[model samples]
Every structure is written in C-alpha cells, then in structure tokens.
Target: MWNPLDSITVRTFLILIGGTMLSGALVFTLAGTERKNLESHLRTHHAAERIEQAIQLLDSAPQASRQAIAQVYANYGLRVDLAPTVGVVGQAPDSEITQELRQQLGSDRPIEIVDQENKDCPAFTGPHPEDKPHCISVFTALKDGTRIKLDVARHDHPPPPFRGNFMRDLITFMAGLAVFAWIVALMTTRPLRQLARAANALGSNLKHPPLAETPGPREVREASIAFNRMQASIQSYIQERTFMLSAIAHDLQTPLTRLRLRLEKVSDPALRTALVADLTVTQSLVREGLDYAHTITTDEPFELVDIDSLTEALCNDAIDAGSEITFDGTSNTTIWGSPLALRRCISNLMDNAVKYGQFAHVSVQKSAGKALISVIDGGEGIPAHDLEKVFQPFHRLEDSRSRESGGTGLGLTIARIIAERHQGRIILKNMGVAELGLVAVLELPLAPSN
Candidate 1:
C-alpha cells in the first residue's frame, strides 16, 4: 500500500530529471544537425579547391605526363581522369559543387556539372550493382585547347570518423544532470518538508512554536511567514473562544448556586425536588461546557506515559468505588502524551460504559504500531446511524438516554479531543447482532523507542 513516489521529494526529483533529459536530447539533436551541415559545406568547398589544383597541375604538365599525374590525385579522394570528347553529357552550372568550382577555376574556362549516371565509370561495368558508386562529373577545357573530364565519387569522401563512444558520453551527461537535479529537488523541498512538520505539530499542539523565518528564496520565505501568521491567528482564535466560555461559566455559577439555596427552602416537597433536579442538570451542562472548551485549548505539555499502568490504576480506583468494572490485557506500551489528559480520556470512556451499560470491560494491546485500548459495555448498542453523532457535545440518545442518566453528554466529546491531541482516535461500533453491547476502541500511536 506504500509507494516511494508518493513522497513529494521523489516526484519532484523524477520530474526534474525527466524534463532535463528531454531538453538535453532536443538540444543535442539540433547541435548535431548543425555540425553535420557545417562539415558538409566545408567538405564541398575543399573538394572544389582540390579539383582546381588538379586542373592547373595537368594544364602545366607535359602531355605525356598528364595521365600519370591524374592517377596520383585519385588516391587522395579526388578521382581525376583525362578524356577526349567528354564521355558523359553535363547539366547547367547551377549546382552548389559546380558554383564552387567556378569560383576556384575562373569563369573564362567552360565547366558543366554532370547530373545523371555516367556509363564511363569503372564501377558501372562491375558485375554487382552495390559496387556502383554515386559519381559527379565535370566537363571543362584545358589551357592548351585540350578537353578534360573530372569525376568525383561518393566513396572518395567518407564521413568523419566518430571521435568517441557517443552512448557513453550521453550517459555521462545524463548522470551529471541527474545529480544536479537531485540536489535541486532536495533544496526545493527542504523548506516545504519543514513547513509540513510544523503544520502537523500545529494540529496536536496549538502552542507549537512558529516556523522560523529562515533566509532562502523569496517564495519559500514568504510561505514560511504566511504559515506562521496562520498559526498565530488560530491560537488567538482558540484563546478568545476559551476565554468566552470560561467567562460565561463563571457568570452562571453564582446565580445557579443562589437558585439551589432558594429551592431548598420551597414549601412543596415534590415541586421542590423537581426544581432542584432541573437546576442540577443546568449546572452540570455549564460545567461540562467549560470542560469541553478547556480540552480544546489546553496547553498541556507531553510526557512519556505508561498506558497499561494508567488503565490499571483507573480500573482499581473504579473497583474501590464499587463500580462493576474490570481491566484486562497489557501492551507494556509507553507513549508521548499529557498524562493528565490521557487519564481524563480513558476515565471518561470507562465512566460512560459504567453509567450507561452498568458495567465496563477494559483492555489494552499493541497493533500495527499503535496501542489499542478497547472499553466495551454490556448494554443495548446504539443505532448505527448515531454512532458518530455520540461524540458531538450535548448529543444524547432519545429513548432510554436522558439528562439524568447520561449526565452532561460531553464525555465522548472531551475524550475525542484528548485522543486527537495525542495524534490518536477513538472509534465506536456496536458489538454486532448476536452480542448486544457497545464497543469503544481507542487507537493511539506508539511512542518511538530511543
């Protein structure tokens, strides 16, 4: 289920490498094409100069030595031959090779480039068709009124030899690019990774320190500044909300206490009992409301807490108080969390089970890098649809659950807040059709060992 490419750094590195390699290949191709074109142009002009020099040499040589001199030039990729009556007919002097020859050999002497195949070539008479070479013939006049034909074959000018292994050089280039891309990916994602860590910590601890305004690129610095500002804003909002709730609870306490005193002095005993009960419910709501707000904004520092020990102590305390509760299972697990907060969380769950189901069964074990604490109650399970809604503050079941039975209804709400602050969660589910009970599973991440 896990993938390395799911990481932002890996994806960024791959994207940089792919994009750079593609761009390099494109540039390399264009450069290679340009180099080939330049080499071809130089070769053409060089071949023309060789032909002009050969002509001058033959023109000045004695007639008897001209044939021998022509044969010597053929060994150097410029095949020269002397012919009478021009063995091959030629085309107009408009081609590139022909124009270069005119520049070197002067316009005074006639010159025509042969465009078609020439039967007079030696390879043309060979038995195999592959032996025949592409030939370019030029017909021109010598200085002494002698006619000569010059032949240049494709084989005479071979392509330049490769200087080195092309593939090896290309691989080396890509490796260098990959190293550079990886460095860039790391540099680019470093700040983002830090920001992500800070954001995650913010979820569990609103008082988490703000991100440092480290010096870097403008965009990264700006993002850091923005994230810090957002963190500060959230902390401020939570503080304001906690203050408002505390103020309201403080104001309600005095009047509620005075009302309780006044109700005790009432004449009608039945009416007074009902009125006092209503006042007690109102007082519990106000107290639990404040407790819920405190859980949200608590600046409780984390410490290593032994989960098994904590649950065992709570179970023993409940047994001492005459509650039908039992604790089982041991994970020997220690986690980084607020001890008091975790105690509050586990106590609330056990209290709910005891109060609603009349009994509580608690257990603890380790699973998949988490410490799972399960508290099951032997009571009619809640409807499937309302399982999640029970965690909402002041939310209670309609039929058998009432203010007198369920208390303030903020137990689960407070418990869930504590679980989430410890980077854990509590899941509620029925015990299934055959087993008529409610199961509460508290899953918390295990503390990393030193």
Candidate 2:
C-alpha cells in the first residue's frame, strides 16, 4: 500500500529527471542527423576533387613511375586503378554526385560517378552498396593525350562510435541532472510547509495574521489568499450571529418576566404551579440559546490556568447542586485556555452524566501532549446510532423526553462547540467494558504553561 512514487518529492524528482533525459536525447538525435548531412556533402565534393587530381597527376608522371604514384594515393583512402573502357555503354551525363562535384570542380569535361556511388544521401540509405565498393571511373584525356580509366574506391566515413570518454560524459550529465531534480523538489516543498503552518496557527488563534499574497508560486499564493478570505468570512459570520442573538435575547426576556409575574397572581394553586413551571422551562431554553451563541462568538483571550483546580471547583459545585459526582483522576497540570469556557464545558458534561445516569464519575489525564477529561456514568447506554445525534442542538434522546427530566437539549451542543473553539474535540461513546453507561471524552491540545 505504501509506494515511493506516492511521495511528492519522489514524483517530482522522477518527472524532472525523465523529462531532462527525453529532451536531451531528442536534441542530440536531431543535431547528429544534421551534422552527418553536412559532413557527407563536403565529403562527396572533396572525394570528387581528389579522385580527378590524382588521376591527372599519375598520368603525367613518367611511364615507369606512374605505378608508384598510384600506390601512394591508394594508401590515402583513394584506390586508383586503370580500366580499359573510356566510357560507359549508355547512362545519364550528370548524375546527382556529378552535378554536385562539377559545381565545385568547375570543369566542363563530362563527369560520371562509378555507379553514381560517391553521392550525398542520408546515412540510412548509402550512396554505395555494402560488400562492393563504388568504383569511380573518371574517363578523361591526360595532357599527354593518353586515354585511361581510373577506378577509385574510397571507404565510407563512419562517425566515431560510442565508447570510452563519450560514455563517461553522457553518464555524468545524467547524474548531474538527477541531483538538480532533487534540488528542485526540495525548493518546491517549503512553500507547502509555510502554508500548513499558517493554517494551523489560524485554527488555534483566529486573530492570526493573513498570509502574504505573493510569497510563493502562483498556486500556493492563490491558496493562501483563499484561506485568508475564508478566515475573514468566518469571523464576520460569528460577529453577525452574536449581534442577532443579543437582540433576540433582549426582546424575549422582558415578555417572559411579565408573563412570570402575571402567572404568580393566578387564583388556583395547581394552575399557577404548572404555569410557572412551564415559564421556567422556557426561560432555561432561552438562556441555553444565549450560551450556545456565546460559545461561537466569545473573544476570550487564553491564559495559563491550573486545570486540576478548575475541574475540582466544577466538581465541588456539582456536588452542592445535589448531583452525585466524584472526581476519579488527577491531571496535576497547567494549560493555556479560557478559564470560564473550560469550566462551562466540564460542568455540562458532569450535568449530563448525573442527570441521565443518577451519578457521575470524572477523570483527567495528560497523554501525548494532550489533556483528556472523561465524564462517565452508570445507566442504560444510548443506542450506537444515537450517540452522535445527541450532540446536535435541540436533539433529545427518546428516553429523556419527559418534561420532568428538565433538559433544554443544548448542553452537549454547547460543550462540543466550546471544545472546538479551544482547538479540541469532544466525542460521546457507550462505555461498555464493565457497565452499561456512556462516556463523554473531551481532548484538548496541551499548551505550554508559560
């Protein structure tokens, strides 16, 4: 399941190296073809000149020395021999090789190649066939009026083959390219690291500065700009929601107070008791709404707090409220957080456990640079499917629907929101190992006490 190519660095390195090799090969191949073309053109014209000159020089020599003169030219890749014929039986006057050679030679004398062999053509298709050398028969009259055929054969010039230092140079270039690709991969990764750090800082503190719009490549710069815009949108949304909730709370509280006073004047004791109870429940729901909104909009700055003592005070307060709650573990730690929000989060957890299960057990500990607090209770555990749904605002479980149970159904929602606001997570699960119960675990990032 793990693949090296899945890594960004490996992928980038491989792509760069492959592209460099392919491009280099393409360039070298094209250049080699053109170079061979030009070399063959020059070789054809030069061979024509040398063949003609060698024939004339040899013919002008003394009759006894002509043979030695021919041997000297033959050793220099030009083989000269005498043929009996002064002309071919029938053929074109100017072949492709002759036309090109005549242009350089500037001789009006009829010129013909041996089977048209010394012509310029692509390397794949040669001017001469293998196993038989192209014998150039230059039929010309010497200055002494002697007619003879000079049969000349020159070996095809081949380019230097790949070997020795040629191979070493090619291999060195490839190795250097691979190193360059790795450096490019490293250069590309730093921008991503900066982006990640900025995002994490934004999550921990909403007031984090925006990322520079032009700090990296185009894609990274655009992503950072989008992140900054999204953060601003979220901040604005929270402010707008808090203002709306403030107006609603103020408008609704005055009517509820008047209704409570009016109900106190009812003649029948049973009727007044029931009405006042309903009014109190409505008030509790309104207060819970305000609490949830505050969780979203609170601008509380974090401070160093003794978490152990904070949770201790919450447990003591729950006991005073006639809840059967016990603190079962010690965190013995200090953390950076808003003291009021953390206390509210823990108090909600304890209230849920004690109200639903008749008793609450609380524990806290430090694990892997995180502070974890778990509130557990002994009761008929919620069904597996309903564990997460209970955290939704105004969503109550079927068993706790009676008015006498007295919940505004926003306790768990507010607690989870507060945890997230502090860069933490809250999860509810059935605690089934030893008893039929549930546990609400809140895990918060551990901050330095300083």
Candidate 3:
C-alpha cells in the first residue's frame, strides 16, 4: 500500500500539527485555571457583602418578627434561621471567604463560620446539572442575644459548556494548521524537485539550458547555482575530449595516405599486397574513430524523418554492395531526429550484423507508440553474459569474432550514443540455443502529433 507519509510534505504537515496542538493544550489548561480562580474570588466577595446586609436586617428587627424576615431572605438562594444560642459545632478554617466575611462584619461580637460537609440546602436549587449540593453556616449573636444562623449554599458561575462549538473550533484549528503547513512544505521542496529533474535530463541532454536562478530561499538558490556550475563543467569536459579525438584522426589521414602509396611501390607483389592491406586497416580505424567523435558532438538540428524509408535505403545500399542482406516489413513511422545521425546509427547496426554474422535481415514495425527497427544476423549468437558488454567502447568477444573481420570495436557504442540522443534505445539479445543469431532492436519514440 502506498503511504502519504512517505512524502516529505505530509510528514512536515503532521509534525506541525502535533507540536501546535501540544502547545495549545498547555496554554488552554493554564488559562482555564486562572479564569476559574478569578470567578471564585469575585463570587466570595459578593457573598460577603450580602451576608453583612442580612445580619444588619436581623439586628434591627423586633425579636418575634426577626424569624419572619430571615425566612423572606431564604427564597433568594440563601437559607436563614433564628435560634436562642450558637447551635453549630466545629471550628472554621481561615480561608478567603471567612476572612472577607470577618472584615465586612465587625469583630466586636462573637461570630462563627462552619463548613457543613455532606449536607444539602433544600430551600435553594442550583441551575447546572454538574453542580453539587453543599452548605456553609455562619453563627453569630444578635444585639438582644438572639442567635442567628445564615446558610450559604455553594453556587458558582462556571464558564459556558462547549457543546457543539468544541468540535467546530477543534476542526477549524486543525484545518488552518494543515493549510499553513502544506504551504510551507511545498515552498521548501519545490526547488529540490526542480534540481532533481534537471540532473536527470543532464545525462541525455548536456547542452540543455541551465536552470534559472530565480528568487527563493538562500539554500534553494545556492543549490541551483551549484547544479548549473556542475553541468557547465561536464559539458566542457565532453567538448574537449571530442575535439582532441577529431584532431588526432584528422592529423593521421595525410600520413596514412602517404604510407599506402609508399607500400604500393614495394618490389615483391606479395609483400606489397600485404603492406597495403595493413595500411588500409589502419586508415579504416582512423576514419571510424573520427566518425565516433563526430557522433558524440554533432550540432545537428532535429526534424521529422520517416524511419521506414531510412531503413529501406540502408538495406538496399547494403544489397548493392554484394552483401547477403534482406529487407522486410514497413512501419510508416515518423520521428523527430537528426537525419544524418539516425542514418549513421542504423548503418552501424546493419554493418555490424553483416560483418560478424555474414548475413543480415532488416525489418521495421511500430509497436506501443514506438518504432522498432530489428536487425537479425545469421551467425552464431553471442553468450548472454557479453550482450551488454559489446556496447562498451573497444569491447569485443575475441573467442567468437576475429579481428580480421575489420572492426575498431566502436560500432555499437556509436550506435547507442545516437539512439540515446534522439530519446531512443537499442537492445541486444541472443536468439537462444534453437536460433543461431543475435537480434538488435532499435526502439525510437514516435514524433508528436500535429
């Protein structure tokens, strides 16, 4: 199964989300605690003031009517009652609410505040489902010595519940983070992708234009500059090598011609014939070396060429030269390529097949959007191990092929170079044990439609 996390962009986005969410969680927790503390402080301050007002009301009222006034205050979420003496047990802890109450109501008279645990205030009701029932009692003596008990139930104004808004806000946060992370990842990786594409094309097209050093991050711009420099270096090296080979081949021609003439003047006919043959072989090697160098650095422009016609012309020329060769089939396929380069490539394949195998069968056909020109020979096929090795410069199987057959061992090498220049390839394969020949298939992509 394909994984999205395999891509750098997805991984970066996920990492941003994880870190942001973790940081947000810590911030929300701390903020929530501070907010709850503030609300509790405000509620305690307001409760203290109300308790002070209620005590004053009981102190000024007639003794018999004081209970009636206390009962009237019970309806507003506070419980109140009257007694003859202090009725509560247990001491109250010194807390914020107790201190605030003592400060608001003077310390002249005896006053007691007791927290009643595991007790419910039946006279008052709470508004929230999560609210627990609890009560606090404050006992103090009135001016007439009548004891008054004030019960304050636990009431709090909690922050509103999240309900559906929690999910909506959560989704919004993640979606926003994802978009921002995606943009960041894409910006970081685009130049790297462009550099990779240029590197791959450099193998097939060294003379291709250099990458643009567009404005971007410092690291990406630096990478582009480095890549362009490397390309220029490689192109300069290939040009220098090609020029050196061409120069050597051109310089040897005059000496080779003079040697051929001098060998013809030998007194003995057999000796002269042998000397001339040697000179001819040396000239052929020089000429093929020059041709191979030309193939490497040709500046020919591409145009549409009919592959079938080119194959027929080469095959017919070989036949006219008294070589045992046959032409079969037609593809009517056209390709965009240099006509001279394509000719040299196909001629090398035909010459190799006929020279080594003694007879050659050439055919052309279109398959799978590519034009295939196959040349099969009549000679014994080469071993499977040496099939790819033959394409290397100056590589030959000496056991099966003799040097006398006249090859500088650069035919297949030159052919493959031209094929690759035109975005095509040549494959070599043995015909197996049953068939005693080698097959060379030149596969070229078809030209684009009009």
The model with the greatest lDDT is 1
Q: Candidate 1, TM-score vs. the true structure?
A: 0.87
Q: How many backbone clashes does candidate 1 have?
A: 0
Q: List the residue pairs that clash in candidate 1.
A: none
Instruction: Report the lDDT of model 1 for residue 221.
Output: 90
Candidate 3 at residue 327, lDDT?
A: 95
Which residue pairs clash within candidate 2?
Answer: none
Q: For model 1, what is the error of residue 38's alpha carbon versus the real structure, in angstroms, after optimal superposition?
A: 2.0
Instruction: Flag regions of model 3 displaced more than 4 Å.
Output: 1-14, 17-66, 69-73, 84-119, 122-127, 131-151, 155-161, 164-166, 169-173, 265-280, 319-333, 355-389, 398-402, 427-433, 436-443
Cα shift from native, residue 377, model 3 (Å)? 4.9
lDDT of candidate model 3 versus the reference:
0.82
Candidate lDDT scores, in order, read 0.83, 0.75, 0.82
lDDT of 1: 0.83
**Highest-TM-score candidate:** 1
Candidate 3 per-residue C-alpha lDDT over 1-450 given as tens digits, one digit per residue, 9 for 90 to 100: 999988787787778778888898889898789889887888677667777888888888877787788777887767777763446554473398788776777667777787654444533355653244555678777777777778776565477746558989889878888888789878767887788889878877778889999998888889899999999999999999989999999999999998888887899999998788778778888998899888888769999999989889988998999988899998887999999999999999999989988889899999999999999987788888888999998787896555677777888999999998888899998877454488999999999851
Give one digit per residue, the lDDT tens place, for model 1 in 282-345. Answer: 9988988888888887768888989999999999999999999988999988999999999999
Per-residue lDDT of 1-450 in model 2, one digit per residue for the tens?
A: 899986787888888988888998899899889888777677666667786687657656886787787678655555454434434443343355677556654575555555435332112224443444444556655555555555555445567657569888988888888889999987887677677888887775566788888765788878888888998997788678777976797678899999999999999999999999999988888888888877766768888878778888899888898888999677777778899999989999998888888899898898878888989988777899988888898898778644577787889988987787778989888878665498999998877752
